[model samples]
Target: MNKKFDILAIGAHPDDVELGCGGTLAKLISEGKTCAILDLTRGELGTRGTDQTRKEEATDAAKILGIAERENLGLKDGFLVNSEEYQLEIVRMIRKYRPEIVLANAIDDRHPDHAKAAKLVSDSCFLAGLRKIETSMDGINQEVWRPKQIFHYIQWKNIVPEFVIDISEYLDVKLKACAAYKTQFYDPDSKEPVTPIATKDFFESLTYRAQDLGRLSGVAYAEGFTSEKLVAMKNFDGIVL
Candidate 1:
């Protein structure tokens, strides 16, 4: 199998990626960049929908965004920890994908698992580059691979983005992808018990949050992210919005 991807995004759960970088991923895919999602958990503890339903929803959302691949790690929801076992799992994936850039869950968030998963992925990225910490898959020896950069997407909390991407052209497409998870998001007809994120306000907030970020960046719509290291651009011409 080819061990390469333009981008690999890791989130604590299925919908987290859709809520955070759906527009960015859509734009990249439209530009012919290969992208994939690696959800740490199946979101089994969510208030709405079973793990099976969420898997289907995530599949539909990935198709809507035209992503090249989507997969879940099957970690226990709400119980993700920064441990050796988890780090090894992530390291294996990092080597498997060999992405140039990785987008991970926020460093801090309302969901505790998000932060834990972020640290695990970040650590695994560094470990993946070390020839000593070996990791493999499918009985085959995997090459040590590390992404050039890792950017953490902002969600649930406003941590002041290190940078925001102008995704104005793909904002509507992002909403379409998010709405693909009908079993998890706002669905008035669904009889499932509502969670904090299942309310109508949650859906509206997705739009307003992007709008707010866009207003600051002087774009119609944008997505925010915080990076541990500042971005080094080869040329500044026309890149900043």
Candidate 2:
């Protein structure tokens, strides 16, 4: 696989990435870095959207974020497990994309699938680097590949972030990307069953949450994430002043 990505954002569902780290992704893509999205499921179990609609919505969201590529692993929604079968599927994607950085789901969240997918993706990243764990795609053998680092995005739970990325200029883009999932989020006109995220307040919370994180970190808006391992900085040159 010659298509290498600078970052691969993995989520349990279609909208999880948009909710958790859309602005951060948009910022990276704007800077000319290639990014991709790996959705573990089609979100078929979501209350308001069908699998077909979520797929369409995901496509629109990917376009809004200027993603280099997007893929769905077709895993069963709401039944995710950290099994070898699942890990091998993820390993194939990791080897295919060869991302240097990976953005994963929160360590713990309101949705059980979020936490399940987090561990699944994290373990797969390590497994992908092992030469013995072989994976193939489209009849081609894959080389071992591992991300240099992983950062878990904040989700439904307010688990404190280890670091925050300033996204003051990209918050609107983030909101837009999340909004692309019309059925999954707020819409007064929709007659479909109202879900937790479909409320007007939940829609507003997106902005406020980013603003709150930004306030704490001294930026207008930001996205928070926790590193899986301790990160070392070579110098203070890249530190935000």
Candidate 3:
């Protein structure tokens, strides 16, 4: 697609974007912002689902979130490394999308891949802006483009947030999108191997965590993000009381 996006959310695995920022994404799309999701890997190493299953679930979740586009980089799961090769691949996507903001994996999380992907995406966002660092797509040289801001969505850890977006009305949308990953979540009927996220408690944490953040922020529900740079607002009027 040739259309520029307002935001691009990149995740290490298929469900990362959905669990971390689905509510914010739904809210953004409802407000008419163009958004896309890029999965760094298909989550092949996960206990419960096959790569193909995750891919299908991701597609369904993308549709539920009203994403403009979704693409996978085919990176190796569990063995994710912040290498130049991976960074270049991400740089290519950054130049292609030309997003104003980038939502990436948490800086550090319970999953090792999460931290690695965080660095990979953050570095690629910088490298993508350097005209000398060349990349091409579809046999055409891509333009050098950089996002104005990069934010890290909270994942498995209860890390403090730099900011929280009010997603009171969009929380249901987020939960439903996450539920699309039936094979990966708390599906009691599935005879698949149990994992940390396959438990009922894990499913409940998705809602309670958002609720706790909302309680702290005085919103009914919200998604939290951490940024490398300070977030500045044009005026205090935009701040939720």
lDDT of each: 0.91, 0.94, 0.94
What local lDDT does model 3 show for residue 93? 93
- List candidate 1 segments past 4 Å from native: none
> Which residue runs does candidate 3 get wrong by more than 4 Å?
none
Q: What would the per-residue lDDT of candidate 1 be over residues 1-241, giving only the tens digit for each residue? A: 5479999999999989889999999999998999999999999998888899999989999999998888899998999988899889999999999999999999999999988888889999999899999767988888999899999998888889988888999999899999988888888998989888889999999899999999998988899998878788878885763
Clashes of each: 0, 0, 0
lDDT of 1 at 235: 82
* Quality of model 1 by C-alpha lDDT: 0.91
**Roughly what TM-score does model 1 have, to 2 decimal places?**
0.97
Q: Write the per-residue lDDT of candidate 3 for residues 1-241, one digit (tens) a residue.
A: 3458999999999999999999999999999999999999989988988999999999999999999999999999999998999999999999888999999999989999999999999999999999999889888888899999999999999999989999999999999999999999998798988888999999899999999999999999989999989888888996899
Per-candidate TM-score against the hidden true structure? 0.97, 0.98, 0.98
Candidates, ranked, lDDT:
2, 3, 1
lDDT of 2 by residue, 1-241 (tens): 4478899999999999999999999999999999999999999998897999999999999999999899999999999999999999999999999999999999999999999999999999999999998778998999999999999999999999999999999999999999999999989999999888999999999999999998998889989999999989999896578
Which parts of model 2 have CA positions greater than 4 angstroms off?
none
